[model samples]
Target: MRLLVAFTCLLAGCLAQKPQPCASPALLTGTFTVVTQNEKLEIYCKYEYDALGQRMRLQQQGTYQTKPFIQDFLLLFREGAMYQIFDTNRTCIKSALKDKFHPMEIPKDATLLGQAVLGSSSAPGQGLLVNTWTGDMSDKTGKYLSVVTEFGCIPVSTSYQTNDYGWEVIHFFNNVVGILDPSQLNPPDFCKDTVMKTDEEPLNFLSLFHNLP
Candidate 1:
């Protein structure tokens, strides 16, 4: 059923948080474009942090048209592990969550859905949407916004709908912080013979790891 409620909310967002505190360098770099729809999809993300906001490299890249078209993907969560590099599914998935933190779990009946001022102009902040979850968008629920800075919240956006299907991002931006070249932090090399996908099976693909929550 909807992939078993999206794998039980990705195992309850990796067993709910525990490893936070590390993510400001202006919340690690920027670049945005969310535009979601059946396929007007935009998503041209970017990130590369390290002094603890952790995320050592993440490059989403997109610009869709329809019928499953995609051309960019890269992620690397380092240390406590996580890596996903789907050059259109050539494959490279891995996972590890030790002392877990920041994977997912904003839905305690999420609701707000309003606020303002996002990023870019000298890093604007104070955005909000508090939460939302219109339910069953294939279990992704939907809508979550968070920007309030002083180096805190930061999430940005999300959306989903079901019936035929839908997705949304609308817009997002972090601005540009730093740290990203240990040769772009591994993963290429034709995805290094693809193996990595862990969770010790029994059902843990998590669709090639979508950066925790």
Candidate 2:
């Protein structure tokens, strides 16, 4: 009877175990698809992120307002600048980088919602373990939920909503641990003559999309 009780306790403990918080690699490349809650916008992007250098670059192609658009963005947090490049028109807009660099990781205060397997666990070596976490945005105006791989802490998906912006969902995939080309983070040559617009409010990712022509 004692042995049976001990076995049951061990099983229960295993079932209640939680995953530890983990941060993604400092440098990585990935592709993501973004969809807005209103369904008015959908974008597919290939991105390169350098957390250590506080920089990011994105090649974006999307349909907005029933029109197709292509844009490239270079965000340099250290220099406090953001470049929006239109490849088709050879034009660029420079604005201040208002948002701070936020690494891809589970927030320290995030609450773990649950864990699951992405694939069938019945088959050996066929399942990918993942965890979901939720938290309020740092600004307290929004909330976010994210899913990440259990082993490497790679982002799988994230959804966030604010009172002003509604909601946006981003699905990440095909991520690798290192940047293939560091030069990708540099501003395009067309942006060399672009002057920073000091009259307009600084732009974040969502605002950039909403204001797209």
Poorest 10 consecutive residues of model 2 by lDDT? 203-212
Lowest-sum lDDT 10-residue window in model 1: 202-211
* Residue 172 CA displacement from its true place in model 1, Å: 6.8
What is the alpha-carbon lDDT for the whole of candidate 2? 0.87
lDDT of 2 by residue, 1-213 (tens): 999999999999987778877899899999999888877788999999999999999899898866898888899988889988787788898998888788989988999998999998999899988999999987788899999998899999999984544798999999999999988898878788888999978777556667777
How many Å off is the CA of 4 in candidate 2? Answer: 22
Please list the C-alpha lDDT of all candidates, in the order they appear: 0.46, 0.87
For candidate 2, the per-residue lDDT at 184 reads: 88
Which is the leading candidate under TM-score? Answer: 2
Model 2 — TM-score against the truth? 0.85
